[model samples]
Target chain A: MKRILARISYDGSGFKGYQKQPDARSVQQEMERALAKIHKETSWRSTSSGRTDAGVHALRQPVHFDTTLDIPEARWARALNSVLPKDIFVHECREVDSSFHARYDAVGKEYLYRMTCGEDYSVFKRHFEHQLREIPDRRLMQQAAGYMLGTHNFSSLSSPRTAVVDKVRTMYAIDVLKEGNSWTLRFVGSGFLYQMVRVMTGTLLEVGFRHRRPDTIPEMIAFEKRSAAGKTAPGEGLYLSQVFYEEAALQKHLKTIKKP
Target chain B: MKRILARISYDGSGFKGYQKQPDARSVQQEMERALAKIHKETSWRSTSSGRTDAGVHALRQPVHFDTTLDIPEARWARALNSVLPKDIFVHECREVDSSFHARYDAVGKEYLYRMTCGEDYSVFKRHFEHQLREIPDRRLMQQAAGYMLGTHNFSSLSSPRTAVVDKVRTMYAIDVLKEGNSWTLRFVGSGFLYQMVRVMTGTLLEVGFRHRRPDTIPEMIAFEKRSAAGKTAPGEGLYLSQVFYEEAALQKHLKTIKKP
Candidate 1:
């Protein structure tokens, strides 16, 4: 069997997240169907790094699948893209080690949330950004972010709707970059829980709004109650940016950003 | 009567261009319907800079309409956005003078044609870009562009299917910007013939491929025959960047993009 790794991006506005579920449209289901057509098999299993909810968009969602077909690595990418819907695409594909798994062998993941305080937005970008007409205080939000970083139990930082057992997670970095009225928050960590990043972002936004203090986040984390967190940020602004695996070589697969 | 100007953008894959035609799905028809809803009557008249063909996208397509309603300038932007389809959007809307017209009052227009020679594209951007795996020679294309700039009769550069009687047009600039494997051809002209920009891009692309010489363009222009030009570039990659008007002060009704 040969393993293939693919880096993918999608609008996600029309999908019920990344995972396949009955009675709903999903990127996974569409991808698996496309794969089955390429491999000409009925039982092809595919795995992704994690699940993203309905209406959430992804810039780079890594997935790996094993196949026995004697297809060239480049042909697989072309075939899958040809059969898949226009809204979803597989941009890059390459062969990897047989032991490499998209979810299990992953070391870390990165996410980005884009927020804008503009009174109006271009209809084209409405599906990708969260519009907030009222400007928020950045200084307060930054102070709150400082408290949320490092190792902590994020049970209070997630939604009550989530039912994950283990709540402890380490956040290596959380950087909030602001440019005029637009702000982009980036979070890099080992993994994320159900709606964890969205909830954390909402809590921080409340801090920016002066409804919560930056110093109060520590107590919220200690409470271990979901009610301590702020409202979950809209999924439209969330993006699963990158996934890292220890077994995979990063330099060869990463896209280079050329300076103008 | 109040006049409103709207700057718009769209993914035209699902649209039948920007005109209202009988029994065809057009962007103008959709906008007219939306306007009728606001006016509480079906009678509506609007004008656009020009019409874009099916599957042609736009970064900025200007249009103006007359209405008697007293809606604020910003509210028109928001209101139109709310009712517009997901693939189309109103970027800006402002009140203009009654004499303002989207087509007749135009002084200049700019367009862009993106051509890619990449191995493959991300599935997300496939709709917005044209893919051509082979890199064409840029020097030859640039040399040909120099000859095509300035005043000329564009009769040879248009489609035989067009009904327009006038063929003379003045081109202010034609530039080819190369970034990595993608070459984007930009044109600024006083006006363009039907499918003229696409044909010019296609012919210049042939020059880049060495199939045609840089000097052949002038002969084709002098010939004044539609068959003299190369094939029309695909509509998917064409964008109407901007429209300039002589009688209008652009900043007088600006709601966004602060003036210098």
Candidate 2:
């Protein structure tokens, strides 16, 4: 058996979410359906690096699956893209070791949130950005984002649906960039809880708008309550940009696996 | 009655064209419907800067209409946007002279054509760009574009739907800009005939791909037949970026009309 890894990108507007539900359309179901056509099997299963909510786009989503077919790794992307919908694209594909777990072996993740501050909404970019009438203070938002760095109990930054008890996570970086009328917030972290990025963005925007003080971020984190954070930003502005993993670990595992 | 001039932007994917058709949905139809709601009257007419083909987007499409309503010029945008669909926006609205015509008063126009050459097609930008597997030679395309500049009879570049005998037009500039995997061509000209920009882009792309010679552009113009030019590029990749007019001329005409 050969294990295949694929890097995918999708416009999440048409999908319910990344995960599969009985009646709803999902990214995973569409991918699995396409895979079934290629493998000629109905029982094939695949795993993603992580799941994204509905209306959340992805630039690079990693996934892995076990296959019995012996096709060239480069050709896999072309094959999958031919059958997949126009909104979903398989960018890269490669043969990987059986020990490489798409979810468990992942090191970090990066997410981006885009907001446009202008009175007139851009019809072209409406699907990709959250539009506001007033421009937020970038310096204040950046100061608030600084407090979110390092390790903390991010329970206040997650959704109420998050049932995980251990809410501690390390944030590597939080960057706020403003260009023209657009503001982009980038978050790099070990892992994220359900709707954590959206909540954090919402809290930062409140600080930018002077509704909350920047110094209050630490207290919010300490509260460890979902109610302490601001409202969750809309899903349309969120994007799963990248998934990070150690190259050394991948190389180590590759030595033990047979070539396809 | 006051003549109102407005700058509009729209995602043309939802529109059949800029002109009103019997059974098809058009940008003019939507704008007129919104105007009818504001005026509490069913019959309203509008004139656009020019007609854009089906699936052709616009960043700044100038339009004018006669209204008896006494609302402030600045408030017109806000009022229209509140009722217009999400895909269409009135960017700017102002009172204009009765002599100012949306079509006849225009001095020049600017069009943008986007092409992406890469193995992976971006799902988010798929609707706005034309994708190709092979990267075209930018220098070759630029060279061919140079031949298109200056006053020329563009009859060969126009579609058969163009019934006008006088096809002479002056091309101010044709800029070919390449960044990463995306190539953008900007055409600034006195005016364009039916499918003129698309045919010019297609011919330039043929030159870029080594399918045609750069020097053939002048020959194509000399032929004065539509069949002599290359294929017309897809409407989805084209954008009516800007329409240019003399501010002095507008001001001169404004002095003759009574202010609202």
Candidate 3:
């Protein structure tokens, strides 16, 4: 058996989400369907770096699957892309060791939220960005984001339905950049709970609008209640930009999997 | 009565074309529908700077319409945008002189064609660009484009179905710019014939690929036959970027229609 790791990118407009559901369309279901066609099997299971909500796009999503078929790693991307929907694409594929778990081996993640602070909405970028009528004070938002750059209990930022017991996570960085009439917020963290990034962005936007002071961010995080956070930003504006793993661990896995 | 001129933008994926047809969904039809709804009338007519083919997008398509309703110029954009579809946007609207014509008074036009010379196709930009596996020689393409920058009989570059008697036109400039894996071809001209820009781009691509020499461009133009030129590029990759008009002429028209 061979383990394959594939890097993917998807529009996410046509998908319900990344995880599979019984009836609704999903990225996972579509991927499994394509794999079934290639492997000539009824079903196949795969593991992803993480799950993204409906309408959330991905620039680079990693996934792993075990297969017995003999095919070159480079050919796998071409083979799968032929049968997959136009919205989903596989950019790279390579053989990996059996011990490399796509979810467990991940060390960090980066999420991006895009917004257009223009009075007139853009026709072409409507699907990719959230539009606001007035520009926000990005400097204030940046000050508020500084408070979120450390270990904290992110329960206030996560969805109330989150089932995880440990809500503590380390935030590596948060950057707010403005280009023309567009604002982009990037979040790098050890891990994010369900809807955590969206909630954090919404809270930062409130600070940018001067509705909340920058000093209140630490208070919100310490509250440890979902009600303490601001409204969740829309899913369409969020993207899973990248997934990070330890280079040394990955190299060791690759070395063990090489043919003697 | 008031004449209104609006700068419009649209994603052409949902539109058949810019011109109105009997049973097809065109951008003109959508604009007229929205205008009728605003005017509380059953029908309305509008004239655009020019017609764009089906699947050809427009970044700033200038259009004019006559109305008896008394609405402020600045409010027109807001009111019309409320009724227009999500894919169509009215960026700017203002009162113009009745003597102004959208198509007849235009001095020049600029069209943009985007191409991705990358192995992997972009999911988000699939509707906006043409993807090719091999990278083209941009320097060679630019050399060939220079031959097209002058007054010439463009019958060789236009569609055979074009009904215009005047085939001679002046090309102000043709620029081939490359950025990373993307290539953009900008065509500035006094006017373009049916499918002229696409045909020009195709011929340039042929030169870039070394299938045809750069010096052969002048010969192709002088051939005065549609078959002499290369194939027409796809409509989805084309965009009407801007339309130019003589400021003095527009000012004179505006002054004539001004209330005493």
Better of 1 and 3 by TM-score: 3
True contacts kept of each: 0.66, 0.84, 0.78
Per-residue lDDT of candidate 2, residues B23-42 (tens digit): 99999999999999999998
Q: Lowest lDDT 10-mer window, candidate 1 chain A?
A: A251-260
Alpha-carbon lDDT of model 3: 0.89
**Order by TM-score, highest first:** 3, 2, 1
Error of 1 at B207 (Å): 2.0
Candidate 3 regions with alpha-carbon error over 4 angstroms: A118-120, A247-260, B22-24, B247-260
Candidate 2 RMSD to the real structure: 6.4
Task: Report model 3's interface C-alpha RMSD after superposition on the true interface residues.
Answer: 0.9
DockQ, cand. 1: 0.41
Specify the highest-TM-score model's number.
3
Docking verdict class for candidate 2: medium
Candidate 1: lDDT over CA atoms? 0.82
Quote the positional error of residue B11 for candidate 1 in Å: 4.3
RMSD (Å) of each candidate, 1 decimal: 4.7, 6.4, 6.2
